[model samples]
Target: MTRRTPSTSHRRHQRGVSLFGLLFWAIVVGFFGYLAVVVFPTVNEYFTIKRAVDKIAAEAPATVPEVRAAFERQRAIEYSISSIGSNDLEITKENDRLVIGFAYEKEIPIVGPVYLLLKYEGRSGQ
Candidate 1:
């Protein structure tokens, strides 16, 4: 058997890994980073709205109209709060205070479906 020497060009070609691999991992990290920074906050807002709604009837004045008005105020607050960021959220009265809910739409990082929806509801205490 004859001993063969490796060419310098071959060594250079095999050095490290492909740039494509690095790029692929970069994209994945970017996506997850976006989820952590952006998506998580929107999700938090959904729960926040839910928590706020759950307390509305208890915290609001003891009247149907008062509850309704409080929900409307919540809607306004949702819009105002979301406007400060990339997350776009909306609140609508479904049926009295028993079915009030919120929906959100966001432009996800490198993802489609530019909208996300979330709902919450509560009933008046008798």
Candidate 2:
């Protein structure tokens, strides 16, 4: 009868994640997932506002007041534009082209006293 001893090379070849390592990776993935869930709505709102600005700019009302009023009307129609009002829009005329610009900051709470600040800025054009 022959008895074989366990080889150190065989033990080294067998590898898998430990419980602590698994939990660490899980927490990392979960944290990013949570961040994405929190930040998605604000990103959606920014795009919506950008669309509204581009639409208003393409129309290009006669005067600055008219442009502001037009944005107000658009905002009333789109309920997601609560962050910035008509007064917040920067209306400019450059080289016979009417430009609509908007900038705003949004703070998303991740934890107690920890917030993610997002600054969104955009102008109407191609």
Candidate 3:
């Protein structure tokens, strides 16, 4: 009977890593990457909305009727974004500032029904 060397025994015991391990991690990273792709745009849009709201606020009309008209214009822009699909934008006036809110839908590649909403507030120019 021949005895096996320590190195041979170690090599035999140390089996190569399974493809499944690599595949599993790949799946995880792919999922996160997909999520980042989907979510990042919405986040960027939220920031954009914030900046736009500030600009609108800075330029809003001073009178009540004009303020209402300003709101209507804001609504028109919001509805346009909503028409595309899972995104909605809305603006409201509170006290002396206008509050802008965004509703973002998270539909996965095919179409999953998860939604998220983000809001921002800013003051209108007098």
Candidate 4:
């Protein structure tokens, strides 16, 4: 029968995460997860707004008011686009093509006195 004791070299060469290291990584991952959970909805809304704008632009509304109204109607339907109002849309005609653009800021609170500010802007495809 042979009994083997852990050598100093083996102990020093051990590679693994300590409890503290694991905890630190867990906290970091958890924090990013929390941020993603908080930010995803706003990002979804941004995409929704972009889609609505693209649709409106493609439809080629006659007037700026018409574009704005179309966006309002879309907002009423989507319910996710609450960050910007119809008036916030920038309507312009580039080469006689209706281009709708918008920009808005979203503030997300992560913790006490800590907030994340996201600026979103997009223009409809011609």
Candidate that scores best on TM-score: 2
| lDDT by residue (tens digit), candidate 2, 1-126 | 656567623454658999999999999999999999998899999999999999989997999899989998989899988899988998888999999999999999889999999999999995
The 10-residue segment of model 2 with minimum total lDDT is 5-14
Estimate, for each residue in 16-113, the C-alpha lDDT of model 4 and write its tens digit: 99999999999999999999999999999999999999999989988888888899999999989999999898888888888888999999998999
Answer with 2 or 4, whichever has the higher TM-score.
2
Which candidate tops lDDT?
4
Model 2 accuracy (lDDT, Cα): 0.90
Q: How much is the lDDT of residue 24 in candidate 3? A: 94
Per-model C-alpha lDDT, please?
0.52, 0.90, 0.53, 0.91
Instruction: Judge candidate 3 against the unseen true structure and give its global Cα lDDT, from 0 to 1.
Output: 0.53
What is the TM-score of each predicted model, taking all chains together?
A: 0.46, 0.91, 0.51, 0.90
Candidate order by TM-score, decreasing, is 2, 4, 3, 1
User: Which scores higher on lDDT, 2 or 4?
Assistant: 4
For model 1, residues 1-126, the per-residue Cα lDDT tens digits are: 656567523454456658898999998898778767766766666565665556674473555566556656776767633422212223334445443344445454445655434333223232
Q: Give the Cα RMSD of candidate 2.
A: 1.8
Worst 10 residues of 4 by lDDT: 4-13
Mind giving the per-residue lDDT tens digits that candidate 3 earns over 4-71? 89866656455666799889989889977887777676566545445554565677556545544654
User: Which stretches in model 2 have alpha-carbon errors above 4 Å?
Assistant: 7-10
RMSD each, Å: 7.7, 1.8, 6.3, 2.6
Off by over 4 Å in 1: 1-17, 74-126
> Model 1 compared with the native: what TM-score?
0.46
Arrange candidates by lDDT, descending. Answer: 4, 2, 3, 1
- Model 4's TM-score against the true structure: 0.90
